[model samples]
Target chain A: MTRASISSPKPALVAAAAALSTICLALAPFVVREGDLRLMIEIFAVFTFAQSWNFLAGYVGLMSFGQQLFIGLGAYFVFLISGKAGINPFLLLPLSFVFCAAFAAVCAPFVFRLRDAYFAISIWVIAEVVRMFISQKDWLGSVSGLPLVATRGMDRTVVANTTFYFVAALALISVFGLYALSRSRMGLALAAVRDNEGSAAAVGINVWWTRFFGFVLGSGLAGIAGATYYMSVFHVEPGGAFDPNWMVIMLFIVIIGGVGTIEGPIIGTTIYFLFRAWFAGTGNLYLMLLGAAAVVTMLVAPKGIWGVLRSRLGFELFGTRRLGPTNHRSSP
Target chain B: MPPVLQADRLSRRFGQIVVADELSFSVDHGQCLGIIGPNGAGKTSVFNMLAGVIRAQSGHILLNGADVTTKAQHERTRLGIGRTYQVPQPFGQLTAFENVLTAASFGGGRRGQDAADHAASILDRTGLSKRSDMPAGALPLLDRKRLELARALALSPRLLLLDEIAGGLTEAEVNVLVDLIAAIKPTLAIVWIEHVTHAVSAVADNVVAINFGKKIAEGTPAAVMADAAVQEVYMGAVMDVAAVG
Candidate 1:
């Protein structure tokens, strides 16, 4: 019976889901309003950002305070390269991942020496430094910002639709990609490291490399999503692109939704978007309300909403658990 | 032939506390070395040194005659040093199968079906087959201890270090665990630090007793337990060697 579960029809379900998502992606541009499409693009990008951080904090046991560092860098990479090369911003999405990943790789050796909260703050410091550096550079539009030069003359509908498709693709990949990752050997390694470093090492896992891989992958995903977000806006500045607000949004979503479970962030992101939509008119009050929601969720459901729901409902979507064999034999 | 594992005059101290006082021992394949010591006598610390979790201040660890003192913990694990914690340290969120599977995959260097099969077999051997589906964190204390042993075996190590695996178990449970260890006793060299002396004597061919991080007795289990100095060390302890045997 347990063996049967390993060969379950999860593949068929995933294929069907992917097909439906692609179909929706194809049709949404035509059916959805321009403003709504813009909103959808931002929602997907923001969710992807939350999901990547969730992977790092929950899956890999690394809490990073400077996630905005990647966001700003990703946006900067897209705007700067597209402006100078006269290339479509959409064409440069993958490079944003490479650049952020490389930056993380270079930072890991030094940053890893500081553990837990210190490691988190070190990245934030790096983000602040990069933001200041970008703020001072005149040619890179330091203070002012740069526009998507390639998209300036393109048809408004064409640009929005294309951005939707690209951002939508990134969103789909983040979800399915995270699910697939959570089931792999590396996922088990990450879980082990997160649970206990001594046990992880005793079990022959290279704890350092496992964490480094997670950090790079999570940061790279954030970079890709950040680029997609800025591409939708058609402008990127040092302050807005590298804003600490990105960290706040991610933390609020992941914390209130669920810290570890993939489904938790999905639920959390939806709630966050709704809260924003409902409170959009209240200006700064919305941020305060978001904080209240998080505090209440913590008091009521410390594990997040999905975590509570999962315990009560026993519904599992992407958990990497393999239950024991059921006693299927008949008794006389 | 060189013993499967040999510790040569290992010494380690934490500030003013000496946890290992020039400790030296050897266990060859098919041999079991039962280490008995009072609490804070550095028994677990010795296991930690052997597993490379903690490096000794000055000593050499030889695995099959290869000096492994400078190797990283996981490197030592890959070189066939597997250990269980005094208090079971499992990947709590992972199922029992996953705890073993991770070790088989990374430590044992097995992959795919091989790792799975090995993990399953280890679970069966450790009498955790019925609980393999449950998360390690959710398991009862007895099963958690069994899971620790199962995870260590998953490494397929040449030298197995059992740290208080029999502690906090009923006599019946301890007997079952002893039976399991005895059945596989000849396949690997085992260094077991156990408070339950009878559980140690049941399978141990030889025994060493430590006091304040120094070896005070070494001989057959019966001989070491009868040692006057070992008895002296246990005078103020809650569990005495004579009562257990």
Candidate 2:
């Protein structure tokens, strides 16, 4: 009854690293410009969003392209309820998560019935449907969208500071949430399903139900990111609300970093930001560069940056808490 | 003891071909039943139907006298019906231990610590305790077969369905497997489809010969192998000398 134990340097070290990184980031406001800090907040939020997508696509093999549907819902719900309904935006953020998660749960049965490529396309279509529907709505600001007409509980300066703090908090939570999920039994189920659905069933795991749960949980995380983003931006238009570009950006982050690992998205997002800053003045060139980079990454380093680091140097920026390909090897 | 598995008038057809035509059989508790057939005999198809991988067009399968004809594959597994594929398809990304652990958790319905213990025990029983940390996909042919058996054992099945478990092994490997299976025979009923006659004869209490999906002969392994109809069915198909050796 002795289970095989792969070498792991305690979860405490990983937790410490996460805490240290968070503290360093929280104190970043003193040395950094407001613009750079804003970008960092955006990147952290976006990194979480991307990692959520990766959890479904990479680990569970859900391959959902309609994650923006929940993202837009997260952004729009917080905008409407807090900005227009005149509620304390920060307090209302959890509500957005509930709403978005509920929406994903309701839609899961229908969308999950479609297998592989069709499932991916169905999510995309659903997001577009939501976007088009919002574009035609009157109270929610049709094509032009709506702005936060009134500020509730705080002035502009305080709101900016609070919003940055909220973004940083949510990002940390996202990392922890992903860490917890990947380490748990659910994460093991997802990896099994991703590897072989038939074998998973033979082992008595309900593949469809596990995948649906992962999809919903991931969408809930995206919903949290969307809510925090809405508070900072203070606006929601249909075009901006359900941005297709956001999906591509998230996908890129995960692929560049490492698909199924926690640090993959973080590393990918950091590299993406550096590139984005360098190429911002070149207009469409940034998109082209990223596209080319993605193609090259897929061809050359299909495992991505974390994959390379792990294989070459036995590196783990985030603690090893989950079952993955690495867990299969017998070490000396 | 009551029959561990009973298939009542299981019938299925594919256009003009009847794969399982009113096939009825029962395996008693702690019995080992070996199924033999020439190529295209639908032996695997029968295992598939019993495991709930493929639904029978008509008829019912009862485990412990409870009908489970309409249950899903995972449901059947949860009900303690574990099976191994002929090709040995273990989860490629998982270590041999994890593969068995998943089976322990889901099929055996054990919780956290209990599941791990069950998985480790299953691995040990299958002679895979040493190679537990190796990825299933990376294991050698014999080890892969061991892992497949270990995975099924993890479910702690009341009835284990094995499809061609010894089809691709050396004679020495087959002997090793036969001994392993012999040791586990007292615990559960097993229905194994095999081309290797020695492995089947070594462990099975009963043998059934199938052709075109119907039972051609059924009795003790020696008696069934000696049946004229069974001989005609496997004539020139399998060398008798090679099987005995």
Candidate 3:
């Protein structure tokens, strides 16, 4: 039986569900008020960052504890270009991608040399090194950080900028786009390599090339996230830019949502933000509760929240494109 | 004549313990060669050297009489060498068809719909037509073996290397595997390193036996199986199978 004819919900039904989600988001600002609107935009930023992290760790079998290195650097690059150099902030976004990609290219050989846990720890060390170096920069505001704008009056447009930025974030997220990209030929190669590197090489795959491309692409996305996140926050510093809390948030999202599929990040980010709102007044108890919940979820649903839902529904919300019918037979 | 693939004086060492030593062998075009050996006799090392995953300590490897000793694994694959592992390894998350599609696209240099068709046909030939859309990890033992064959075949290899694919299968499964190997014989040369004596004998045109990284016998399967030294190395196990003769 082909997936196309597998008695799934009608396209209209799926479209209606998507339309409802869009409508909900569109009306959220009016119903939830300004503070909640700003919070929701922040949540979208977190989702973008987490999904990129999920792409690297979940699909590539890479655990990068130092993703903040790129995210922080991208934030700083945009802050420097826009705040100090007086360039339009939007122009500085793509420039951050280029800079982060170049850095990954230079660092690929060195970082790729390390295996497993060593690779994870090495990346974390690299991030700390970068953070410390930036912390010592007097002109860049050192530990105190820098204002994202030179004057108070120009910054009055922050609300509109944040709103427009959220729209752009949602557009770029485009779950279907990510799903299509991840199901392409390159994605298959990456999945094979991730499953078994030695076998992948034996079958004529360039394992290194597959992994390096995934790493670089993932880093670029993280950088883009950092740039946009800085605009949302309206400031940049070593502490805020290199916040390990963002890493914690991302890991929780991927772990709680589902690491490998596109839906995981979306589902994860929504659940995470909801929990945050529910427990905001609990102080350290909130963080402790999140930690306990993450551990419990991982233990109970190791594939993450999306995996649970997919299993229950017998659906692949995120999957490859269909060109024609598939001839699937049961093995005897 | 220049052989289609030639490995001269190939050697491998793991810090003083030699796995392969000064081994020289050649596979001519459209020739099926069987390699038999005791456990850990380094038959897979030869395959690894030919496929370019591990470099030989000192040797010249020529593909179609052109040196490819230092080429990368993917480059060697593009040049028409494909291999299956002793233990079949398929992408657990991908469907069997998707796994083969990757081989067609990246290894065989095809693209899009053509690559998909190439993969599907390869799967059909390998008896995996029914399980194409099933996740590879969910497939049974025999299907997993077929997935490995399908993956290698999807590359449209000029030289196909099989590594102990029948090692753990039942006698019946071995027979099915042998038939499949025989069916593909006309189009591609095969180098099958197998532990299952009968299966190798059933398919190989010629057989070479190795002991301690050195060739012990080379000839027809029946002749090699009957050789005193070849029988001696099997440590009396072949004596029981001798009744089949």
Candidate 4:
């Protein structure tokens, strides 16, 4: 057999892009204003959420409308551990993630039983049930919610900056982690499963387990984002934590940015925040505009904005290379 | 030696329509068995059962003498049963190389560089090396068929199941596929379900005919094709002129 070399065409460019983003985010604490830090945190939170959703819907073809389940669970976990148990709020991130992962694992067998639209709705129903259950729990302070009491004694600037850094790290991890995954064997399996489950099975991919993994990972990330959000805000409520609007915004970002590509979520989230900032005073009109924009993006470029730009420019910053001869030789 | 695959009294029904009834068949190691039947004759159903895509109400599917009737489709593939669909379904967003590489790694149980090497060879053999970088969904029909075959072959299976791979192909393209299959047949057992009689006749050592979920004829390709019951089943059916002539 002839030797074949498979290398990404623009590895340097991808590396430079990664380095640049890291540098900018790392220096954000010194350069960014306190108010702007809050906005940056919001961007990071939504970025992580969109990344999680994109992993599920884009790579696994598991369209979910109840990702808020994990987000809420993360917040509640932080509250239960830090707010009630008095653990340091910063140390609660891992606990929140693990709890959300366990919750997802338990939900998998039941949710996997449903397909497509039913699966989406079933997940939403599960989130609602969780919210309602949490609302009635007296230890969680009932529907009134709980505050991050652990952060009460800390300096306001120190708490805000630390939380800001955590959120930024999460955003980086979500993007780079997904990028690395999309280049792995498991990532190939994910794409296979997404494209055609029947064909994926025929090729020996465990379709159920692959989707389950995606579900768990996506949920865990969403949980972390949720925990960070509530930690920064110093409070968590069932209503705010489990809001379905989280999923709505995530879907809009993913759809407008690009559904299946790594670049989509970042681009989508950036566009989303820009629009939100520009229309901050418009209230409900802002949401309407976002919805309209998503509809227009879908109709105009179903692959999303990143997808459109990638196709038109013929460049992929994080695209995985095909594993075969790069030099195209004519067939025999 | 144990047969590569055996289906014992396999039966299935879709409400009122019986797709397979007591369908028993076996193919030895390095043998090529061709299955021919008219439309809705349960030919694809048998392939589905063998591939574990559909369950049989009552039957045993054995791979190398081990019962696999309870196995899931992916498990069946891992157990050395690789198959292609009638309508080829390749991963649309992935490049052809990625599609085959996925199977080579996951189905063939290779990893890392080994999987890449295996996938590369398969792509070259399938005449898709030049088109390996193209998204599979963009491939022309003939190339798509080749991709299906390449993906199935990536499993490095003990038994290969091909469904209508020669359909929607020019005579020359069919010939190319026939030669490809023939080249690889020496090392693997093959069960080919095809409406293209000439393609089947050219490559299959044995032929089986079925209609209404029952095996109507089985023997050497020439004998089965000439069987009276086989002719009767094909007569008045649209496939009759194409299959029998």
lDDT of 2 by residue, A173-256 (tens): 767767766666777788789888888888898987887788888888888788788667777788976888988898889899
lDDT at B146 for candidate 2?
A: 87
**lDDT at A221, model 2:** 82
lDDT of 3: 0.78
Quick one: best lDDT, which candidate?
A: 4
The DockQ figures for the candidates are: 0.56, 0.50, 0.48, 0.72
For model 4, residues B113-192, the per-residue Cα lDDT tens digits are 78888888888899998898888999999999999999999999999999999998998999999999999999999999
Stretches off by above 4 angstroms in model 3 are A1-34, A150-155, A321-332, B239-245
Model 2 chain A weakest lDDT span, ten residues long: A323-332
> What TM-score, to 2 decimals, does candidate 1 have?
0.95
Top model by DockQ, which number?
A: 4
Against the reference, the lDDT scores of all candidates come to: 0.87, 0.82, 0.78, 0.88
Write the residue-wise lDDT of candidate 1 on A1-332 in tens digits.
12312222255566678789889888998999998999999999999999989999999999999999999899999899988988888789889999999999999999999999999999999999999999899878978888889888889998888888888888888778887777778887999999989999999999999999999999999998899899989889988988899999999999998998878888989999999989999999999999899999999998999889899987666645643333212111
DockQ of 3: 0.48
Flag regions of model 1 displaced more than 4 Å.
A1-9, A327-332, B243-245
RMSD of 1: 2.6
Model 4 lDDT tens row, A81-105: 8866778888988778888998999
All candidates' chain B TM-scores are 0.96, 0.96, 0.94, 0.96
The C-alpha stretches of model 2 lying farther than 4 A from their native spots are A1-7, A25-33, A150-153, A319-332, B241-245
Ranking by DockQ: 4, 1, 2, 3
Interface RMSD of 2: 4.0
Error of 3 at A123 (Å): 1.2
